[model samples]
Target chain A: MKKKLNLRKATPWLSAIGLFVLWELVVRIFNIPPYVLPTPSESIIVGWQFHEAIWMHAYHTLYTTLAGFAIAVVFGVVLGALVGSSRAIYDAANPLLVGFNSVPKVALVPVLVMWFGIGTVPAIITAFLISFFPIVVNVATGLATLEPELRDVLRSLGATRRDILIKVGFPRAMPYFFASLKVAITLAFVGSVISETVASNVGVGYLMLSASSKFNMPLVFAGLLVIAVMGIAMYEIFNVIERRSTKWANRGNPTN
Target chain B: MSNSFVELNDVKLRYSEGDDLALETTNMKIDKGEFIAVVGPSGCGKSSLLKLVSGLMPPSEGSVIVDGKEVAGPLKIVGMAFQNPTLLPWRTTLDNVLLPMEIVKPHRHRLRKYRAEYEERARKLLATVGLEGHEDKYPWELSGGMQQRASLCRSLIHEPELLMLDEPFGALDAFTREELWDILQNLWMIKPFTVILVTHDLREAAYLADTIYVMSKRPGKILVERENTLVRPRDQETTFTQPFTDLVHELRSHIRDVRES
Candidate 1:
């Protein structure tokens, strides 16, 4: 049993390494020019060689995503609570929210650039906008879909509406809230990078764009690797946080 | 003007105006600390009756009074359980049980200061329901029977004057259901809180209640009100007795009549 557990734990790392090795074999076998498609080894070697630049860009991207995500969390929860709790607010805002979410966030980058002028502000704002929707939608869904039986349990206690929301609704929404955080954090990275590529000079997105313009495919791949790693690191952090805080929600899933 | 603990007078309930009535005009008089079971066919609005009595829903036409006051909203002196148990999944068995103390006033205010005192009370209730050590486990971690037991503890923890149950044992298997019946009976025998238990199970009604109310199908109103004189502290053997069989048979026939009609 312990051996099986160890194998299960090792699968992700094994799969990742296997993919890199396959990429190397495919590149060598196909004799693909690095300018068109670089081997994983070349990407990693190039990435390490420019570690200082890559580290700076990665750090900036990480902090920007975190900042936007922080804002999104606060507003998303508040707006979600409002929209979820009352029929009137939901009816009034739902169409607008739906319309807003439907418009691809990438389309908004130019408008953000126009308003905020090509820099950190535009990147941060874009990150906030792109990531905000899921957090709000999930939080609202969590509160809105509270089982009627559960509501009756609280309502039957003579609990006020506020009391019900605070005591029951929010706690019930924790799993959904965390689920949104994971998605939103990843999207926040996308948002930040989109803004960086279009409007800013700093961050991994900008570095990749710079490398690509110079036809430095290996360097571009290196920057891509940096962004992917950051996204995965953030995702893992939220995953751990979720597993610790909402174990009850994961019932019937194999123990993580 | 009667001094019944819970009285529903000419009560009618509709989800909306000009809609089909969920409950027709129904009247009931329950004495303080009396245990009553409501039994009927499916869709008989037995649950609607409990909701009215507990003030979770108001009757459309007539006044419903409890403890000398007309119920304008949900009553504080009521503890409720449903077929689903409805224990918060996020909460530990004990925390779920103490949910009322976090809401019902005086207790909510004093919860921080007297949390330990309240915990002891909650612990005793859990112990009474055979959930003493399982208190710290999350509700989802427990079996269906154990979760339901914790729900029962939660309902009674606040020592409400009226305990409203809507098929509280309906989801359990037969053996677990029977075990819970005995546990519930023992607890009631000790404290004797007024109970309004709604169930489709005639044997359960006969075993646990002083009075059994049978209701008709939708737009439900009481069809029969039978008083039980069964021996006290009813057990498994009592269920096999001739009188018990007779009572269940009688209730079954009434239910069959309603279902047929």
Candidate 2:
């Protein structure tokens, strides 16, 4: 059991290093030229060579991603709370939200670019658009699942609807909000990259697009790795927060 | 009696139009600071009685009066606890106990200004229920019995005039249930309030209540009302006494008859 745990802990690093080795070997044995697919070493070396420009692009991506996520958080929670509280609003809004989510967010990037011009704003809007759905859904579920007994007890004490929402509804949704943040943050990255590739010129997605156009496959691969690392970093941050704020739910009675 | 604190006069109830009557025409008079228990077979409208008296539901046919006014909606003076221990999972035991104060009228207004006073009252109640040091712990972190203790505190903290309980100890183990009975009786002895506890346990009704009312099956009406002669501060020892056993037996026989018919 201890050996298994040790291996489990090592799996992520091992998988990462093994993937690099496999890519390097595949390139060497197949004698593939750098224009088509560069080895892991070549990608790293090229990525390091243009570190300053890559760094600038990465910074731009992070800034736009965070700005979009912040806006999504505010709008998603408010909309979710509104939808979750009343049966009428939930009924009216459910189908509309599901329909909007079904349409691939990438399809909207071109329209956004047309309306807002080719730049950071469109990318940020795309990130905001793709990420808010999960937040709304999770937050809604949190409020919807409140126990009937809890509602009855509060109402018996003359608690108004607003009092119930502030005291119980919002606080109970904290863990769910954080869970959605982790999911929404990663999706926000996907949105930003998609929009940047289609419209913007300053982000890592734009840099990768230019690199691909010029047959600089190594630099494009470097941009992909940077996004992966950033996504993992953001996920880890939210995971820690979710565990901290909602530890009570997990610590429930063992017999239960 | 003219001095009745809660008086139900020929009350009849149906959940909605065309539905079967949930409770039949019934009348009851409860004096101030009295403790009563309503026991019946499952689906016997015991809970419906609680709702009607607490003003959570209005009767279709008769007038229900409490504190000299007809109850139109939920009264501000009632505090309730349920079968399930519904302590807010996000809040600590102390905070959960302090919750009703943040909702009930006069207390709600004063709570923000006299935070320490309310906390002191909550702490005292929690300690009485043997939850002294456990106040900082969250509801889910505590055992079932502890959570119920916290729930009891939540109901009483507002100092409500009418306390309504719907099988509050129904989910607990036998040992925990008995332990809470003593704790609850202890709390009541110090400062009496009007209480209406609806339970399925015959012994619980026999042991805790000043009077016990038995109800028949659905579209229920009162079958019998037996005044408890069991004295105050009754403990586990009292449960084994001849009077207590006879009282439990009497209630059990009535419930068995109701269930069969």
Worst lDDT run of 10 residues, candidate 2 chain A, spans A247-256
| Every model's TM-score | 0.95, 0.92
Tell me how far the alpha carbon of residue B235 in candidate 1 is from the true structure, in angstroms, after superposition. 3.1
- lDDT for A12 (candidate 1): 93
Tell me the alpha-carbon RMSD of every candidate. Answer: 1.9, 2.9
Q: Write the per-residue lDDT of candidate 2 for residues A143-191, one digit (tens) a residue.
A: 9888877887888888888998899998888878888999999999999
Hey, what RMSD does candidate 1 come out at? Answer: 1.9
- Tens digits of per-residue lDDT for model 2 on B41-104? 8898998898888777889999999998899988888888888888887788999999999898
Clash pairs detected, candidate 1: none
DockQ of each: 0.72, 0.65
Flag regions of model 2 displaced more than 4 Å.
A1-11, A25-37, A252-256
Model 1, span B1-261: residue lDDT tens: 677988888898898899999898888999999999999887878888888887888788998999999999888878888899888888888899999999987899999999999999999888988887898998878999999899888888889899999999998999999999999999999989999999999999999999999999997989999999998999999999999999999999998898898
TM-score of B-chain for each predicted structure, in order: 0.97, 0.98
